[model samples]
Target: MTLTFIQNIGGGFLIIMLLFSLIYFLLWVYCVIDVIRSNFKDQNMKLIWIVILLFAHIIGPLVYLVLGKNTKVGY
Candidate 1:
């Protein structure tokens, strides 16, 4: 009985892990696409952002969401 309970718990954990991984992948893809389509005068800047998003993994998207915007506004 105890073994069966343990197996069930492990299966639940695996499902949770898979779900989290799918979410992570989706978030990463979203970041990549946004970066590619973003308006930046300098093409090099776009490339740099793409590299950062690809190499920085989880932190990349969070960083982009926080700091990857044009701060200027109309006068």
Candidate 2:
């Protein structure tokens, strides 16, 4: 009964969270792949960014996108 009421009323919240989670995972994977495929002036940057993404889950990708993306040197 309670579950049904919550589902009826608050189901939008669950859907929104699910969507956000999917988008977030995609962003993380994209960033990780970009880091691998990119070359930086600093060779260790790739390893460091991968470690950051591996351990820093939430903040790592955002930081990489904002700060590190521009640091790529070559194709």
Candidate 3:
């Protein structure tokens, strides 16, 4: 009985981890695509953000979303 319970818990943890990984992967892809489509004007800025997000993982994307520039208006 104890063994069965442990197996069930382990399986549940694995499933949750897998789901989190999938969600993270999708979010990362979306962020990269969105950054590419953004009107940042400067190609270097866009590239910088892309590299940051790609190398820095979750925090990188979040930082970009919060603080990155949006070049919709004329500058």
Instruction: Report the number of the highest-TM-score candidate.
Output: 2
How far in Å is the alpha carbon of 64 misplaced in model 1? 1.0
Error of 3 at 49 (Å): 0.6
Please give, for residues 21-64, the per-residue lDDT of candidate 2 as tens digits.
Answer: 99999999999999998899889989999999999998999999
Error of 1 at 29 (Å): 0.4
Q: Any runs in candidate 2 off by more than 4 Å, and if so which?
A: 1-9
Give Cα-based local distance difference scores for all models. Answer: 0.78, 0.89, 0.78
For model 1, which pairs clash? Answer: none
| Model 1 lDDT per residue over 1-75, tens place | 988876778777989989999998898898788877777766677888889998999799888777777521211
**Candidates in order: C-alpha RMSD to true structure:** 5.2, 3.3, 4.8
TM-score of each: 0.73, 0.82, 0.71
Off by over 4 Å in 1: 1-9, 71-75
lDDT of 3 by residue, 6-29 (tens): 677877798998999998888788
